[model samples]
Target: MTDTATTSSSGRRILFRVGWIVLLLLSALFAVNHIAGIWFIAASTDEQQLFEAFGVVNLLAIVLLVIPYRRREWWAWLTVWLTILPIALVVVFVPDAIGITYVVTAGVMSLGQLATLPSFRPTRTAN
Candidate 1:
């Protein structure tokens, strides 16, 4: 690649990494918010358990976001989908203000994941 091309490529990679990091942060924040919401709101035991379970899953997704995928970009893609699925379910089941929040956050996070796809190939060292 030409010098300018290399610089541009490097910049793109940095941007992708930053985007992924942002998604991770947002996911963590969402999970924390869900936990807090559960604590503040009065709910049946079953409902509390269900929301806590979802929060745990979100926490796991945040961890998955940081794992080294190397050549397996699909893993990263899968992580993004997994992160969105629960929120999508909540939106479907609730269809209220909280559901709207889940949908919007999931949408933004999905966009970030999609933006990173072009540069998602395996690293040279991983090959």
Candidate 2:
């Protein structure tokens, strides 16, 4: 409705919205993919454990990213940083996990969102 949310093709607002949507979708896909490894007793214990482990961490990262917190805070910063380790694990160990790429892409989006921090300037100057 306002200039910041305008949807014109050339508008920064539109581009930002598109970027966010892409990131959210990627995160969702990653969460669901990891959840796919269901553990029924006596049925592929190793695979199930692996999936649960990956899924829990991926889900936690996605959840943290969605919280309404400023990027500069410790928890918000931690969310971005903490996401890197498991992603690296997946990339190195499980090449078949298509969702790792998606999670990584979403992590990029989180970084981009954090980049917006500089735009929030206070009207008063500091001493």
TM-score of 1: 0.79
lDDT of model number 1: 0.74
- lDDT, residue 23, model 1: 79
Clashes of each: 0, 0
* Local accuracy of candidate 2 as per-residue lDDT tens digits, 67-119: 63233245554455565456645555656655577456646756655543333
Listed in order, each prediction's TM-score against the native is: 0.79, 0.54
Instruction: Give the alpha carbon lDDT tens digit for every residue of 4-30 in model 1.
Output: 767867976876886687678888887
TM-score between model 2 and native: 0.54
Off by over 4 Å in 1: 69-73, 122-127
Best by TM-score: 1
lDDT at residue 108 of model 1 (Cα atoms):
82
